[model samples]
Target: MTWLVTGGAGYIGSHVVRAFEDVGLDVVVIDDLSSGHREFVPGAVPFVHGDLLDTGLVEGTIREHGVTGVVHVAGFKYAGVSVSRPLHTYEQNVTATVSLLRAMAANDVDKLVFSSSAAVYGTPRTDLVTEDSPVAPESPYGESKLVGEWLLRDMQRAAGLQYTALRYFNVVGSGTPELCDTSPHNLFPLVISALVEGRTPTINGDDYDTPDGTCVRDYVHVSDLAVSHVAAARRLAAGEPLAPVYNLGSGTGLSVREIMDAMVRGTGIDFQPEVRARRPGDPDRIVASGGLAAQDLDWAMRHTVDQMVRSAWEARRASRD
Candidate 1:
């Protein structure tokens, strides 16, 4: 049984592709290379450079590869950018998903593992959010993801498609030296870039009601999240019922200041960060329970914040070198 991984050349997608291969699964990639790197796709897997919105190309790829399942990871992910470009976000995240599902149904490829986000649960009133948490997305990126999940649910009910939507917190760390995250919107890389250039990493929102008055977030290793994709895919293939949603994370929270301190510790670099006003749509604190994932999917994150920072710093350093 072969799999078609959308956005398979991107940061987390490439890592999931590698994880799939590690477990002996046949893999093929379809990426537009807009935010992904061509060099990230391993030579063993065949890649199709195209958009998921192109139904004909997507359908053809599924049929050509004999793809029995898909891991949908292609979408706009920048929170602030999505706000300014909501139309583009909707086009890439929601509209593309609808088209991709239709193409999958047409091709008889029904199984899927979706890459969702914690942004779906806006500013959580409670620190630890479960799968049952209220679905209130604050940003265009979050709303688009929620809409994607809704699309899958409706499609599954009507078209017999089975899917698992893994709502990720902040996905940090690199897959390998070759697969480092290059997103300017991502906080870790942005901080790393600042340190590399001898500039202070800026910290926004110093008065959030958290322990340290900075925004707290759950950070999960990209590799661990990728492993969950592999596990979920295999379980779906083995006839497990479609458990539509699960939160993926370390089940702990780290503040922005703490993360910066860890980065400084990891790199032995020091510069007092500039304080800035809270950005719009920025939440005070967000952490995942991930109990459902642990119970149903047997997933648990093994990487610590220190590990996450060290690995991320290592990847960023190697990329700069």
Candidate 2:
């Protein structure tokens, strides 16, 4: 079955595309290049440069490519910035999803894999979040994703849309040197860029109630995450049963201090990270239990902290060249 991967030029999407290729699946990519680099897309894959909000364009692409399934990975992903740009966030994440669903229904494409986020849980009271945890999204970005999932659910009831939403937490590392996290707000890129530029990386909060007095979070390698996407897509194509939502998380989490120490060891930058005041609404810990995803999507923490740092550092440095 042919599949269309939205945002397939971005870090995680590009890796998902590669994973599809590795499995010998025919895939097409659609990316607006807003935050994704064109170079990240493989030379051999068919690419359509356009926005998803254009329903006609989305429908034409699906029909032209004979797409039977879709991996919806495109969205406005910055949680902190979404507070100021709520409209833009909704337009990209929610409205765009509506448009895509419309086009999918029009063209009879019923299978989908959505790239959701852990932010949907907001600040969970418990340290280990399960799939059944209450969804109280605080940011517009998170709300948009939750809304997207709701749309899919409603569509499933209305049109028999087979789907799964993968809720990601702190996605890091690289499957290949050609693709790397470039988000200005992501911890890995921010910290790695600071070190590469000879600036000290700052830890947002060092007084959090954790073993290292820093915020603890789940950080999964991007390649491992990509594998799960392919698995979800395969399951969808084969009509295998799947949960509506799955959390791709490390059952246990690591602290920011531990990440910084790994960066120091990996990059040979033997400098301490600066401690800064805690950002408002920052939770001390937000790790999820991947038990559900582990059983269904073959999810596991395959990369160590040092390996995540090393792979990300290598890819970031390569991109600068």
RMSD of each: 1.3, 0.6
Give lDDT tens digits, candidate 2, residues 238-307. Answer: 9999999999989899999999999999899899888988999999999999999999998888899989
Model 1: per-residue lDDT, tens digit, 113-226? 999998898888887898888989988999999999999888888987889899987889876777788898888999988998888899997999888899988888899888
Q: Model 2 off-target regions past 4 Å? A: none
After the best TM-score superposition of candidate 2, give how far the Cα of residue 261 lies from its true spot, in angstroms. 0.3
Best by lDDT: 2
Of candidate 1, the 10-residue stretch with the lowest lDDT total is 296-305
lDDT, each prediction: 0.88, 0.94
